[model samples]
Target: MKINYLELKRVTAMHAHEIQQAVNHVVNSGWYLQGEAVGTFEAEYAKYCGAQHCVGCANGLDALTLTFRTLITLGRMGEGDEVIVPANTYIASILSVTENRLTPVLVEPRLNTFQIDDRLIEQAITPRTRAILVVNLYGRNALTDTIIRLCTKYNLQLVIDNAQGHGLSLPHGTLHSAALPSPSVVCHSFYPGKNLGALGDGGAITTDDETLATLFRTIANYGSSRKYVFDYCGRNSRLDEIQAAVLSVKLKYLDADNALRRNAAQRLIGEVSNPLITMPSAEYCHDNVFHIFPVLVKSPDTLQRHLQDHGIGTMRHYPIPPHQQACYQAWAALHLPITEQIHREEVSIPCNQTLTTEELTHIIFAMNSYDK
Candidate 1:
């Protein structure tokens, strides 16, 4: 019994008939882009996130880029404005800021929560800091109460990269974090592997501000609110009808599916009590959807190989920190020890919705069996 890291095929198979119907409907509709399907999904997703509006985009990166671009179009942010972001986040989070010509001030994460340390955010802020890009890394909320207050005290816009956290929410509500931010914008990705994944690439931006929402809609559509009337120099990025329709179907089941992932995470946290391995803190369990179950071990490579020997597939969430990447030559000398250690030690095991009880047991046993 081979246990793959994420069985996307099984995920799709879970609702194949429903998804097929939605795809067939979109195919027969003849109105692919900017159609009713996208509009309906946008509205539905906004309601789900407790936001007033949602703008669908082609992919997650563009969703983030357009949010920043919308701020820039409105004269809120501009070239070289510093946006504090997580150093341990996926490269896309950093890319979104740099792609818009905004300076990314990478902040280290709280080793316990795997979230941006709110205590450190104040130190990173300067007069030029226009926004804080808080990422919900590994489906855990980082926009805590302190970070929200910091955003208010410093008058910085709060932008969330919620690409990994589709169905996740604080116990109080989606709006309230344990100490969550009053975010100005939250971006989502429906990439095939995401919690609320579409068949292919998809993304959306949710916001309460009407002006920003309208601007995001315009910017995502090649800077046009109306046909052939360009307002800003924007690129083309749209969530097609099929992906929107598929996402709409999956959105209905997100919470239920997330529950399964959480169960798996809890089991792992409870069962894998090896002293050499460090599982994520269970403190934010209620707030997390467990998009990827990350475990830190002394030798990530050896542990990964050990799991593979047991026929259980695993992957590293990231092998390289963004700052150390070849592209950022100037920041080569900058040392972020915490982020670098996380990059080296983290291993992402199967925590998706499709794992069977037997597979889960096998994985837990394999993890506990690792001697080296």
Candidate 2:
């Protein structure tokens, strides 16, 4: 039985009829850009995320860049200010920071959770630090009490890159309360493969601050708050109409789909007992939506080849650490042991709402059967 890593075609087919109808409506309406569809989706998504406002954008990277840029415009942060980010995260996260001329202070993630180590954040904090940008990598909740407390103690802005964590609820009680400040914002990506995906590239920012929300919307729309009125030097990054309508349909099922992903991840965590394979801690399994079911092995390439031989496909969440990339050669001398180790050993298995029971069982069998 051949099982692909993630079959987006199969996933889309689950609601193809509704998606088609939504697209047809847009095509016939003679409106495509900023229209009623985008407005409606922004409202629905804002409610779903429990935020007061949502600003749709062109893509995830734009969502992140716009948020930081808005903060700078508000005089809350500025160029040369530092933003703490996870060292093991995708390059896009760091790029958003550097794009605005803000310095990115890379902190290593804990090997166990594959998230930024909160314990190390405070020590990395210097007087120049103005924000804490926590990435919810692999759909895990990166927000912790320590991280929140540090932000509060130091009066730093809080930014969340929820590109992979669409349906993950903020932890209950204090963790949730502490996670949001007046300047706090959550950035989302509705890429084709995400839990809350659209047919094409899409993204949004959720924030309770009305001022910031309005500013983000303006900056994403060619820096125009009104027609022929240019407030800030912005670029065109609107979400468009068709993608918004499609996202509205998918948004209804996001919670249910996330539950399915969690169920599959739980099965893998409970059943896989290979000594060489290190599964994520079961305690935090439910805390994530399981966008990517990752495991650590000494030889990821060998395991990948073994899985491929068995007609099972796998991928690496990331093969190279951002610090080691050629673009950031200036930081090549920085030694990040844990971040480097995760990049070396991590392999992403096929886990999503599209997997069948039989396919999951086969994946389990293949993983347990690996001896090399």
Using lDDT as the measure, the top candidate is 2
lDDT of 2 by residue, 197-264 (tens): 99999999998889999999998988999999998788999898999999999888888899889889
TM-score for each of the candidates: 0.97, 0.98
The alpha-carbon deviation from the true structure for residue 353 of candidate 1, after best TM-score superposition, in angstroms, is 1.0
Candidate 1 runs further than 4 Å off:
176-183
* Top candidate when judged by TM-score against the true structure: 2
lDDT of 2 at 132: 97
| Candidates' C-alpha lDDT | 0.88, 0.90
Residue ranges of candidate 2 with Cα displaced over 4 Å: 173-179
Residue 363 in candidate 1 has what lDDT? 94
